[model samples]
Target: MGQVIYKERKNTNSTKWDDCLEKFGKEDLLPLWVADMDFEAPACVKEALQKYLDQGVFGYYKHSDGYEQAFMNWEASHHQYQVEKDWIRFAPGVVPAINWLLHILTNEGDPVLIMPPVYYPFKDALVNNHRTIVECPLIRRDTGYVMDYEGFEKSIVEQGVKLFVLCSPHNPVGRVWKEEELRKVMDICKKHQVYVISDEIHQDLEMSGYHHIPTATVGDYDEILVTLTAATKTFNLAACQNSIVIIPDAKLRERYDEYLTRIRISGGNSFGYIAVQSAYEEGAEWLKELLGIIEGNYRYLRETLEKELPKVWISNLEGTYLMWIDLGAYVRPEDMEKVVRDDCGLAVDYGAWFGSGENETFIRVNLATRRENIELAAERLIKAIK
Candidate 1:
């Protein structure tokens, strides 16, 4: 583990800080809504970017074997998932990749399935690309969320689904999917002959006891599965705009590559390539320390809120730095924005944005910040709700 440092980011044009007035309609609240970190990029990534700057040659970028090889090696070593070089495609970000994949995998008005409350962008991609959105909401348990396999299959068959977008180590409700769970879902998709896109952007953010299973590694569904992941989330390099799209099936890769070529999309910028390669090669220790910090922050928030607001439903943190808490007991759904933002003075991702109307009283808090921020958020909730 390495030393973790927290820095101020209010005036740096940060979406989390500077855009609070635009997004949350509040300027003075503690910003904890967005997914990016308040910590600096790993020391190694910064040094590599600095080296690129010192050279000062801003020319057109060419493809690099080192970038893809570094990512492949990282995936093989961390997740035990070996990827061949030819299967790789570069995207500026996961969201854009999802949109492109939707266009390639299905026709207009074709149905695509997702599990919600989920990462909202999945729905956005489907809608933006003129595809029908089919949702099989995850079954909520007192322990955590579970896949509703029967319902998922039913939705696929009834809706005439062509694609399924999966959120591995799901966002909002953080359960790192077990191997058995992945296999069950994959089996259902295989039975339905549906194409699957596993958005594994948060695969590396597992907590102390949890492990992320690459969906393709659990079975022989490679022909149907396309994996989307990145070092950006692990290394807080979102601004660099680099992500990896792994297509194990050659035909699918060919179609995706052709789509890129047709759209005149070559690759990401030079900085994105350099930053991602450096992060994948030298960021393991930094990520380990980050997971520890996030775990501690989650413990502090859960313990304090559970002790004070006894009926609050705080989902168990299995992965990702986001904590999902159901404040329905303390505040009515209609009063959520007033209580959480206006009264508590904290910015958070509203639950309604992530799902149907049922989760309106829930709030997702970003935990990848100074422990003090987590403390302040907890203190505010306790004071406002009690």
Candidate 2:
């Protein structure tokens, strides 16, 4: 059963692979960089897409009851998050919604806080909207990552930052936010009247023993918290291009509607509705099995790299199919970055990709592919680094 299948991604024009050749003058590299999985999307999503194609009508669309039902069913069954239908609204992608939320809430030059070596997109979204970003970087203990709440609170108070973007099951770092941790951050934000934007797209990718608690789960009094999630990462549905902005309070949703309407970003495409519904409804079993595969890959990679490349440390992953490898002990951070890209012919997401000086000597590798693929890439990396 561990016979990792090899599916040829060549000539399919995969952005993670083919685009590197086209964009960076290289195509032969093993791509373990982007977040999307190499596995095929669940069958039901394909079937749904096919049905719409069979119908042969592509037109402007509005989200409807079926769409709402899909989200409701999925959230209840898989996450147990129990989101109401009316509470969810559509956006093209989570990044877009991040920018939009910043726009609706903050003014120019106002400070927005984030914990870095977090998501690169968080920094990008803030910069694009002309807001100043205050990075209260997380502190990594011997066992795991913990929030720098003292630093975060200081930033909030000193900068008069009106907003903070929280990345749970944090990208690159892969620590799922514990409930107590979430409570602390939320309480601080509550005290400061700071708006929190929780990017929870990886909620569904939690590993065993870890649960993703929506920032909204703690209390109903706060109108400032908005949780952003999508079927994209979990169901391999990014190409479908839709996300849900969950606003528990009605007035917050009203502000969202106003902002979305002016730009005509109110709903989604016909197939976005179909793909999300199909994924949430029919893709649970597939997801469970996929998570098992991902966890196994994480273990295998960690053991292999630790035993063979002892100097390189593969952090114990608590969530997501991503691995953050501490390569600094092996080589200079910059040289490690170049060696992975050049000598190994492996284009890993360099430490610099997450943010300057944030993930220095730390590179992220997306392991959401067949175990054989991951193993071969690891071997190549070992050979190159050696």
Best by TM-score: 1
In model 2, where do residues sit more than 4 Å from their true spots?
A: 1-6, 22-24
Candidate 2 lDDT tens digits, 1-386: 32222356767867887778765468788888888888888888889889889989787766568777888777776667788877888788999999999988898898999887887889998888889989898887765678988898999999899999999878988898888899998999988899998998998998898888777776653488899999999987787788999988888889899998899865777888889888887888888888888998888888888888888866668887789888877768658646777777887777776766636788788989888888997798678767
Candidate 1 Cα deviation (angstroms), residue 321: 0.7
Each prediction's TM-score versus the true structure: 0.99, 0.95
- lDDT of model 2 at position 195: 91
Clashing pairs in 2: 21-26
Q: lDDT (CA) for every model shown?
A: 0.92, 0.83
Worst 10 residues of 2 by lDDT: 1-10
Model 1 has an lDDT value of 0.92
Clash totals for all candidate models: 0, 1
Worst 10 residues of 1 by lDDT: 1-10
Candidate 2 accuracy as lDDT = 0.83
Which ranges of candidate 1 are over 4 A from the true structure?
none
Model 1, 1-386: lDDT tens digits are 35567989999989999998999877988999989999998898999999999999989989578999999999999999999998899899999999999889999999999999999999988888889989999988997899999999899889999999999989989999999999999999998899999999999999988999999899999789999999989899999999999998999989999999999998999999999999999989888898889999999999999999899998899999999999988788899999999999999999999996778889999999999999999999999988
